[model samples]
Target: MIPTPEIRHVNVTRYITPLREGGSLPAVADADDGFKYVVKFKGAGHGVKMLIAELIGCEIGRVLGFKVPEVVFAHLDEAFGRTEADEEIQDLLKGSQGLNIGLHFLSGAINFDPVVTTIDAQLASEIVWFDAFMTNIDRTFRNTNMLMWHRELWLIDHGASLYFHHSFTNWEKGAQTPFALVKDHVLLPQASELDTANQKLKSLLTPQVLQDIVNLIPQEWLEWEGYEQTTEEIRAIYFQFLTARLAQAEVFTKTAQDARKALI
Candidate 1:
């Protein structure tokens, strides 16, 4: 297996502000490492599973050369947010008093506007293929989950991807399943190079790489009360699911192409 990737770990020193735009209420805060990060608290919204999806999906995108923000583990202690006035925020902080996922905050980033931004055919196609591979359904125009910093596109908020894990029953079926919602993908109209991207990108996701990505999931996340399976089983399932998905890249890629065809 390829060596597991290393993500920076930092202690959250301050809760600067809550980003109300997201349902989970991730916050922008300063870490002990002298960097500001948008920390996704484990106690809010989708809980630990969302953090898992965010971690795994972001790493996969980064490996595929997407300009994703640097993800790190932001540690929150019991005393960190005690002084917050808002009841909801305080409750969220109390519940999330442990390990959480954080993305490096791009200081002056703006939202990506499909009508205004210029994207090439290859890049769009690659992004489509990537989303389809991950079974992501949140890249629609309504909420791009993307940002532009210094004229470069950066992907963010992948917590909505890999939705099958929410139930995780019959997960074997999920790996082979085609992503139909890709039709609503914001970049579908411009994704003319899907087939080419399929060929190039599939070769890069070796089994070792897949394992390394899956291995990045925190042990505590898997130990949640919601799951009936053992931690190892859960981890193996993620690895196997991704491996099967990569093996069936043609299935999902073709589905994306068909979706694109319907668009144009």
Candidate 2:
């Protein structure tokens, strides 16, 4: 069994430059731990849901044996970004004063290029299964959201995952539905072991594993701008959603398998 890892909290020591590659305007910041982290602010356009998704998605990937960056609860004080010259950045920091999400910076990591690096069948199948299980719509060939560090592929930008939470309604249907976008998954063509990945992964995402990931979401994230539910209520919804989804794992597995066969 893969042990559930602890998510640490850190204080932002300094705000570095913005990583403009992503739409959310994540930044490179120094933490009190003396390490650099790519921090995602709660003030971004997508709101707290993005941060919640980031925490849960990355945790799931980590538990599934993927090489994911360490996720942290980055505390941003009211005066954190006041020294920044950019007005836009100042506003972003002001709105994100409490807790945000950050991933340890993988320095010198280059974007994964399909032409230059090859992923084996097992890994590809697992990745496809993971994204599909979570309904992640971002990992397409147009923008793989994967990186190569020290010759090993690492996942990033998982804030687009757990898309069902964006609506937070009809979760039963959401859980029951198969992911139609598997056809566009960047790894689908190479995911020949979908059945194998399915059997192993289903057994790994036990009830305990799902609850641990849901528990990582900060209460502040649950208290977004215009929501009317207690944090515990929101948390319960997420856990149920995941539990229902996992019970129907084969629904998505078959979809991904068919998509791969069509590609071939």
Model number with the top lDDT: 1
lDDT of 2 by residue, 1-264 (tens): 667679899999999899988888899999999999999999998889899888888999988899999999999988888888899988999999989999999999999888878899999999999999988999998999999999999999989988887888677888887999989998888899999999998899999999988987777788845568788989999999999999889999999988888889
Clashes of 2: 0
TM-score of each: 0.97, 0.97
**Runs with alpha carbons beyond 4 Å of true place in candidate 1:** 1-4
Give the per-residue lDDT digits (tens) of candidate 1, residues 53-111.
Answer: 89989999988889999999989998978899999999999999889999999999999
Candidate 2: worst-modelled 10 consecutive residues by lDDT: 220-229
Clashing residue pairs in candidate 2 (N, C-alpha, C atoms within 3 angstroms): none
lDDT of 1 at 187: 89
What RMSD does model 1 have?
1.3
Model 2's lDDT to the true fold? 0.90
